[model samples]
Target: MKTRAITGFFFVVVMLGSFFAGAAVYSIFFGLLAIVCLQEFYGLLKKSGSSPNVATGLINGAYTYAAFAALFHWDVYPEAQTIHKLVFLLVPAMLAVFVQELYRNTDKPFQNIAYTFLGIIFTIVPFSFFHALGFVTNTGFSAHIPMGFLLMLWANDTGAYLVGRQFGRAKLFERHSPKKTWEGFIGGIIISAIAGYVLSIYFKELEWKQWVSMAIIISVIGTLGDLVESMFKRSINVKDSGGILPGHGGLLDRFDGLLLAAPMVFTYLYFIFN
Candidate 1:
């Protein structure tokens, strides 16, 4: 428990620092995080007796970097314009995997290659939305948005845990996640709403309605993200992705909620404000 607390503290500090540091810094940090997470993801697949090659790993890592770069570099190039380039680049990258698998003549090569590709797209692609959101400028207002999202998410998770421990009676989703309860889920939503109200005062750019809307989205979607990761772990019969962090499990586990929440938040911001 002590180790978990210490590690969680350090993780929170670094995460908070990076978040406040601006788009460029956050992009770099999240980019590296995506790479490490992809690596860990492939490792998990391998441990499950699925073979993902080094070449596949490198290509997937490159894909993740490219996605973030495209989103962050939106000022220099339009998103639609860069997306065309992404599709062009991905063709050969994916083909290389099939070509390698065919050359090696491995059993179930196509299945392995497909799964590797899916893992990269599913796990890392959504995070690019975060980079996109960071780059969307409302001057000083943009700076506060990511922090607001983080605080709301953290509050939801923390509130759920505390409430669930104290007064959880009815299970939320027993098969996917046994510990989660309906009471805790409602508590998380309440806490997130409060955090959103508090942040709206300082954000200035967003109205109270927008802030509340965002908070509700984050709480619900973030919980879905956590449940998704829980499902993944259950499918593989593992308790954690990796023991890289004492209590957090793996990079994937730590960021799973963010991964799921980011895209949804980004979409909301874009549609509502843009």
Candidate 2:
């Protein structure tokens, strides 16, 4: 517990600092995070006997994040057509992965292609939505959108852990996660809603209702994201995703909820504001 607390404190400081620092810090922070997560994911696949092309996948994952950054944030690619041109650079880059896999002539060549691309699709695509949250209004940047998501997500996690430990009786999903409880899930939603209410007071980009809605989405969908990652680890017969964070598992373990929830929240904001 002491190790977890210590590691978690620094983790929160760095994350919050990245948010307050500005867009450049935020981009570089998540960009490197995506790369590390993709590497960790591919590392898991390699341990599972699926030799994914780690280097090529990392390149594509970085490229994909770059493409999303260009599409959503960069002013140089202003037009819709320009966005396509900027983003399509990934197509050839992905194809290069396939060609390189063929030349390697390793066993299960197609499986390598599939898992390699899967790592990028799983890790990079979802993180790219962070860029969308900033420019939801078609102009200017608001860290609140992305940061709000993180705040609510943290609230849900803390709530669930505390509540679930105390009164958790029924298993939420015993197969993938034996400790998750429906009671804890409910508590997480309530806590996230309260966090949203508080956030609405400080960040008035949206109404209190909108922020609370985001909390519900995070509590529900983000829990699923955690389960999905647990399922991945269970399938691979591993305990933690990596040891980069000491007590906190790995990049993938820490950011699993964000991986799935960011895109949904961004889509919700896009429809709401656009």
lDDT (C-alpha, whole model) for all candidates: 0.78, 0.88
TM-score of each: 0.89, 0.95
Candidate 2 lDDT over residue span 120-238, tens digit each = 88889888886668778666667887888889999999999999999999999999999999999999999999999999999989999999999999889899999999999999999
Candidate 1: lDDT over CA atoms?
0.78
Q: Candidate 1 versus the native: TM-score?
A: 0.89
User: What is the number of residue pairs that collide in model 1?
Assistant: 0
Angstrom error of the Cα, residue 30, model 1: value is 0.4
- Best model per TM-score: 2
> Which pairs clash in the backbone of model 1?
none
**Model 1 alpha-carbon miss at residue 205, Å:** 3.1
